[model samples]
Target: MTLCLSLLFLFTIQPSHSITTTTAYAADNSLQRVKARGKIVMATSPDYPPYEFQVSKNGKSEVVGMDVDIMKQVAKDLGVKLVVKSMSFSNVLVAVETGKADVAMSGINPTPERRQSVDFSEIYYNGGQSFLINKTDAGKYTSKASLAHKIIGAQTGTLQYNLAKSKIPGAQVKGMDKNTDLVLALKTHKIDALGIETPSAEAYVKNDPDLKMIKSGYSLNKNDTGSAMALKKGSGTLVAAINKSITKIKAKGLPNQYLAQAGKYMKVNTHNTSMFHYWTYFAKGIEYTLLISAISVIFGVLLGTILALMRFSKSKIFHAISIAYVEFVRGTPLMVQVMFVYFGIGIVVNLPALLSGIIAVSLNSGAYVEEIIRGGINSVDKGQTEASASLGLAKTDTMRFVVLPQALKNIWPALGNEFVSLVKESSIVSIIGVTDLIYQLNIVRADTYRGVMPVFVAMIIYFVMTFILTRVLNYFEGRMKHAK
Candidate 1:
């Protein structure tokens, strides 16, 4: 509760909007910093084709698209290497503003709302807007107007989303984080149509015969249609350099060349869209998931034990501190905590994404474990502690030898459940570009355009993993009972 209150107090006192406005032009040397670092990190959501998407080349996964091509040129011009970071579309701009990436470029439109938080390079490509629908519904819904009072889908935090909510009369707007998920929703008839940029809708139409596209038909501003790279506010020098690169590329008509290259890669992805074909992607995801779960479990136990002990301490300060931490963590969602640790504490120290994820999960799990351990300690017969005291055992010795061992035995099942939960919840790390199972699943979905299959595969894999862990835990429970 104390921790939660403190965080809430901080936000209440210094709102993010006010902070953004004040810090928007805080003497940025983003270009100089990039040159010194020798590499420019570009954050993107790799699910939007022609703009940014993932492709597997020679059995190795790679992010490729028109945005990538442009960033590559920008990097070359600046005499630096280009490093791409894949995350959700919503996190792309936050990544730049929070220093996770040098720039964000994933079919991003520079709307006024986005401009307030981040700067954008010159408009590189304007693909316009369109809606994707079932080919059978094409005749019924020829334009955006025909779809009024119907369910419309758009990517959350995009121009299409805003337009759908404001322009479409009586329309139900369903916003999702990924275009792939929106396409799935459209295919399943969960949404009547999906509002998307024309190039992406065209890519989907070309790739999937069941899909069709229609012009949005709304009078749009140039800013609403064009894609641009977003950078931290006050990055004047970096933005200027990138704009120069954009000028050269536009002058040379390189967007057409890049789009053609992206088309070929998309064809390759669709050539073998089988789930079995992308086993390596899933394999890597499983590996990272297990690594994160294992590390978090070890640290969670350590942190939980300390916090639980603190709660029992006679010192008011220690007890208050422990209470604050436990209450705060339990009150908040793990997703928010993950982002806070990754992007908030990140301002003080640059923690790697995987490490940040583990820390957040461990911290979150600790609160739960602390409560569980407290219950177990209470469950231990008070007579046992009394006997320990009668035996001349110190309080610490009693906790370590007499009470703790029995408490752990009583709480073994609860601890096992926590460990299993960690395996599933660790998927949240994907938002920070950690290649966990969920992240890889989304990548496969985007690459294959076979969304449901990847989802089913991931579900099965998770069940198998949790099943094995449960059996292992039951085995230990049996052994402990036998010993008793």
Candidate 2:
């Protein structure tokens, strides 16, 4: 099985290599495409404050920050509207690289490694480097030197993460995708300190009384500290236009103004930090979560039934294809599949985040459902099929009416279990910015600056959702047994 799977992976990767070769020969029309579309989509992770973060204004949630303000001005200069795409910080650059967004700007620092994949604009704002430590440990870990031989946390794929690994002697660096998660880790003593940019550290310190910020005191160039906008490689036209706008903004000191505005929004967010205050955020989260799961379930079952039928077919080609697809999907992680569907397949077809998430999840669930269905069908006695044939019934009718009814009854519990798992697994879509329960939970955590309470609320909500679904499934299962 491992050897077969290895061959399958090689076959799958072959097409992507060809796709890259084709992309290399494609013309660089990044600016022309955006202008023709009349809107430039900018991808960002909105959990970072004063750079890019979510805020409630006039009862509507919107992404806003200095990065957003800078992008807005860039859009204006180019005579186009700015569209914001929010996702995990790690996906921001991927969005631009895959044509999901025209650019990415989330207080991103241009490092040597990142420049290889994406083009960056001129340095915008240098927030410097700092470590977020517990207030109680203030006396023990005072500066960069004190953090030596300590466990340090930093966001993965950021300058801070690299610094934590290279600068600190014997430092066990724990890298996470989101800063809020790292903050929670620090509060729980999972790590001694969190390396972060100075402005973000200050924001966290101001909002949370238990946290304190200390300078990293490491030697760094402007590229290591300065924020910049990342575009797809070969976006010279767009990059030049963005740099021109940035130069003007810097000359007029607009970034300071934008930062001031973001501070006010942050103040509004912190004024009412209660979980109940952000019920709408959770409600919206529940809406999207249920939407993704419900659609995926329906499509998954349909796909599963087809695949199961294909497996039962006498044709070798049909059976081999079904086997390959089922094995491939079940072998890989759902997170990687979601990203592949969104960013990988997206190179050919521009799929929205929600649609990509639903497609990936349905494809994943279909493989498992196919197995459950196959087992259930096998459990049905062969005598039943012979009996149906004896009654002069067609093969299709016999299987659909007699075999399927019994199989469904046998697999009902297993199906229910898969559905329950789907609800939890759907949270993975949040990484692609689907705004499901987990995504909203992160937004609330970032907005309110209260991490634990929002997490607790989301946990209860998920439990309630899955519990209700379990009862409904039980009711149907009971009715099926009553018919017996």
Candidate 3:
């Protein structure tokens, strides 16, 4: 079974390989495989500035930082093309472990548990831990004992996450997928403080005056892994290639030079902040959010209508299938379905993120809409169907001409409510990388480091979207009511 699965993975996951330019002395053979595929894939979470972050250049966006520069040289030396994939930071190590990426280089530090799953390149940038808090709560984290009961936020699978759990005995340590989330949680006081890297803390403080580091409370850990590149386990040749590239880059002091270059791309000006700089982000978010919601609703209603009819059928098999589908979908959470389709099934079919999210959302929404539709059909007067039958009309025509139309009229309000609910719930798809409202705001919050304002804007956008959609649907329902 294991060998069969391995063969299947190789055939499916790894693209067609045309070997070229590989040397014979490479023992690990990862470099040879990469050469055969003709590309080295780098997986990163581009929210970490000065390491990896999105920057707009000449009306286009690109990921740039020290890690990117280092990995470009690695690809250059290996004689392969380079490809980059951005995802949540929590998924990077897993992507390498599962062979989703050849290497992950998003300011990740090694931990003992991570060492068991993947190999690490030599340490690159060494930095300490720091705490960020609202300026008004500057000294709230005076000491370790004082922070025992406070809630602290950190990026999941990081040294800061571990430190927060171990150092602060009674503090509630909430782990999120990105640094920007932790910072936003810090800004809005969701978490009493956030544990961030010293350099990242400095970046945030530099960009926004509302954020300040509590110096006395910040300390270095003996077990700190510093920053390093992660690769699939046992990829000895790839690790060596990356370390050699890192060594050369450092020997020429290119890391610091890269850091200086990245600084020039930061658009945030602490002296002059305005809405003109961020309108495009919220605008794009609104566009995609509406698109996802509209597509999901249309597909959902059509699918739901089918399921409802199956439930009404005389065939037991159809009824059983409809019942099972509705029960299974409604029993599970949307987030789980979204991830399973995006990352789990995505591996098998190579599904795109938008399609995966739409599938998940429609499947989830169909279950509830199925129930609404079924109830609506059942609520129609039995006499209506019997009257159509008395007039010699068939069941299909009876439903189409008389009963279903009336049933639909009865369920229009319910369907509109479901559509509204879906528009709001669509935010969950951002987890699987839809690049909708929430995802864009995360980058904006990190770029500006003025977390509350961007989040506030997102909240308003959501409200405006839902409100306008609700009003439009209500008007349609009124017209429908009067049409009869």
Candidate 4:
């Protein structure tokens, strides 16, 4: 039976691979022909507020700041409708390459490795890498030479990461996916400094009173200019159109205009602000946290049911295997499990990051729920099963009709508890770059350099969501019990 299942899996995977290859090729071809249509889709990361974040007043998306303005002008020059799709920074590159987007217009640098897959337009911005260090330690690292043998943090898959590793050869550089993590690391003194973009570092210094940029300006090599607007290779029409728009924007001085607008909402000067802005940013993060929690809970409940049935089987071998599965899942930490499933399994499987997060949370929650279900099933009186047997009912029907209904009524509260636990556990999925609530809060706190607000907001949001869900579950359990 195992061999047959393995063969079936192999057959299933073969078709999937073929389909993926075909889809990739088709996307590439479609992008090449996009000039025939008058629409250019540009992908940007919306989490980077003041650059490309979504404003949620009336549910209509209005792009703001230098990057958004530049892309819109570029689209107008091409005589195409400009559609901005908000996604994570990493996914932005994939969107461009897959022809889902004509260009990516976040503050993406033109790395040589990226050149192999996509073409870049002229450099729009010229900021280089700099470090944000604790105010007390600011004087310790005066230059790149001084940074040698020190530890620094940077956002992963960035030019800052590359420059930090290369410039300070002896320095220990840790690459984090979220900007908030780098700030947290600095706040906790986990790292000596944070290697960041000049604009981001400037923003951090403005909001964070305890942190300051090193006086000695550290930067990437002059050749490695910070630029934007990445296009897929062979998209000559799109490239030409974007270049013309950039030239026009430069001549008209639109970049400076956009910067001035962005400066209004963001701190332009290096000074602390009232605590009001901090809480506002924190409220923004709550929206994302609730989203991740809700999705994880739904998936976890579905997966738990499957796991319970497997554990309840009559076969001794199945029972032993199920016991091991429960032990393995419960024994490990949720954070480590999230990382393994998202980054580790992601390397082998071709699932989207969000889908991977759901699968991981569900699988983990299912293990505990299995034991809950088994205990509930066992609670059903032995006489009930004996009565079913005397009535000539099969073992499956006896359990399905008599045992399961009673067991479910007893276990309903336990299931609700498991769901509440799953909501909290889902926070770990942020490690794999899902833009869920904790992840969004981290960005807000990092950018604002005020951690208290975002943390508070996240806590309140989680508490409220769990409270509501628990109440609903209790109501259902009561109804079920009364019906019985």
Candidate 5:
């Protein structure tokens, strides 16, 4: 009784909105929800330093920087607590568009594509584009005429990417997911230079002696390039409220003060830079990765069974539908499926990010599982079915007692491979804001600002996970064989 009451109270409770807060949720408005909950949920990418990045103190991790400072002030002006949800820069806008978060801020620039999806506030700060290149050849190629056929990198889905494509006419433009990867890419000459925001470019130069920002060439257009908070379309009440906060802060010149304070702690070695020290990140990553893989596979088995049975059905309709599902799922990339599931179906059903990711993965895996199970059933000899029928068994009983058990035993190893594949493919979920092991590695990469090494460690962690899971599956297979 006590536990039930506690659980009920936890879910039902909502804090009283301050009388000073004018935003009311009479119709469950976004602003009213924030005030009534006494917390504003913000989505950001913490890898962008001086704007937002991770900080470690006494072995605990927290996000801190200029963007966070501004949001904190915004929360204060609205008389609410701020709750931040960190994710990929691409997904940050998705979170806002889906109403999963109240606002999105991470040094995000206003672009036409983004403007079509979400509303932006009055620009908080402006920055032109710049490049961080290798120190060995910093001044070797300044003129656009001399820059032909060089490789340049930028973070995907950002203003810098567009700038790289337009500004450098003859260069190979590489768009990476994380800024740290681009940093490493530049230092190693995987790319000749990296286009990035001015602040991050400066931070990279300041943190490492091997990096230098090229400022004399390629003056990037600053139009629609200012950072701003993002909210859902048609969210004028919240926008106006946040704008009021932005106005107050700019009046006090708080943005400059925040930037100066963030710069003071922006040095790389000022905090824990050791991968061994942040074992919690890897451990949690492995835990969630395995859990998502296992849950996804388990659900895949159930869904696959249905799909397989449909393929075996005599009805052309069920068979066509199953075939179409399998081909479409196999044909499309998992990344696209993840986006549609999260943004399209998720918005309609209002699913959380992790659940949406799991469902997407399960649906993708199920299509393949269907083929595996169907082949296994077909591989069973006709004699087995005849023997079961001769024993006076019904069709369903024959399938259950004779066909499925033998089919499972025959394809156990193939099924094991499917499970193993799901574990690796599960990494795709990280892009959609699932904080599995790979995402944590990016967090560590951004925090330490050492790009390649973190990836090397993540590679080892993934190998270990797949290896252990394979062995566990093998063990279960051996036991099942012995029992049979």
Candidate 6:
């Protein structure tokens, strides 16, 4: 009875303390605290052309756009220095919610689900969504009826994607992760059309002569409602300050000035031309990716073989150390490990990005190869070791002459599979900016405003490489068996 009463008392106190902590945290996240910090971190997606993009002019970063210019005004009004951080659109929301950034202003539209986590400032710019199609198919897509049974692409979780699904009920919609992906899908003939925003589609098609928009008599499910900046929930003070700044910018025509300047680089009108012409710029990216993967695999195999020997060595210290290495490498995620080795180690080692990629991938591959080699070695018969011993051979001689030859024959197939996995795994090195196949794909998507062809090309190249490796390994294995 005493224990039950104690438990009840503890439960009763928990809710009150929790509420007190929540209220205190809410009070702490005020405009005064933000101003005192003297810096406002703004999250944006650099992949969106004419809104936010990364460019180097005379070896300096210049992020120029209507969105950037407006955010700068807001920061000045708040008496805080502006710091822009580039990330994916999805990650922008995460940054705002986590308080990693003061606000997210990369063409964000207020949605119901988003409101649950963060508050949005009043609309800043009015923008409507539209569809871009190949010039040859522009006439055929005059109405919803003409678009029936055709494959259409749109970025995932966007207003355009939702509208396309509801309005074009008969159209097959393929969701992508970015606007560039939608453009690429249309360009490659992977999809007949792409549902995109009007400004973004216009910006993409300016350089392409093969893509066009069907602007005549299309339905607007939602108005090109103005976009707004997102803040953490209940940041009324910050929201009010941003709104006041936006009002001033509108009155001074500063927004228009910024838009006009941005227009110089982007197309302001819809035309029929290929928007994916920039894909040709990423050929060098493909070469870099292949080089990294090939070198990593070669070095990885050599290191793995050495580690495998260590694990099987008679010395207790070598065996223990090898076991620890295998466990450590296999236990961690490849992406985290790659970042740690590249970014973390680069701070101290000052190695080139390509060398860091090779070292990271090789270390990871070596751990798995150790297991594969150990398994192959054990699969060899004990009789071979005993026969070598009877011939007055030393333990090392027995392994080198008798055991390893048979083990290699048995392990050739597994080794080939490991090589294939290593090739695919090399894609992760791109996160540290190693310009692998996926990195090239991203570059092509950004430049051409297209996403499918580069990915398709990458997939084909990986398949061809794996196929050839398999054939070569199989031929070697066959020769080994015939010799025996």
| Per-model TM values vs. the true structure | 0.95, 0.95, 0.86, 0.72, 0.88, 0.63
Model 1 residue 99 CA deviation (Å) reads 1.3
lDDT of each: 0.90, 0.91, 0.78, 0.69, 0.81, 0.71
lDDT of 5 by residue, 438-469 (tens): 88898878777777777899999888988988
TM-score of the candidate numbered 6? 0.63
Could you tell me the lDDT of residue 234 within candidate 6? 59
Candidate 4 vs. true structure, TM-score: 0.72
Candidate 3, 401-464: lDDT as tens digits? 9977888889999999999999889888777557788878876766666666777888888888
Candidate no. 1 TM-score: 0.95
Best by lDDT: 2
In model 5, what is the error at residue 157, expressed in angstroms? 2.5
Per-candidate clashes, comma-separated? 1, 0, 0, 2, 0, 11
User: Model 2: residues >4 Å from true position, as ranges?
Assistant: 1-27
TM-score for candidate 2, please give it: 0.95
Per-residue alpha-carbon lDDT of candidate 1 for residues 1-484, written as tens digits (9 for 90 to 100)? 4356446434432314644533644666888999999999999988888788888778888999999998999999999999998888888887887788989999999998888778899999998999999999978999877999999999998999999999999999999988889999999999999999999999999988999999999898997569999988778888888999999999999998999999999999899999988999999999999999999999999999999999999999999999999988998999988888877776657778899999999999999999999999999999999999999999999999988999988999999999999999999999888999999999988887786999999999999999999999999998988885
Clashing pairs in 5: none
Worst 10 residues of 3 by lDDT: 15-24
**Which candidate comes out best when scored by TM-score?**
1
The stretch of ten residues in a row with the least summed lDDT in candidate 1 is 9-18
Error of 3 at 132 (Å): 2.6
> Sort by TM-score, best first: what order?
1, 2, 5, 3, 4, 6
For residues 155-209, write the lDDT of model 4, one tens digit per residue.
7888878778877869899988666667888889999888876666766676667
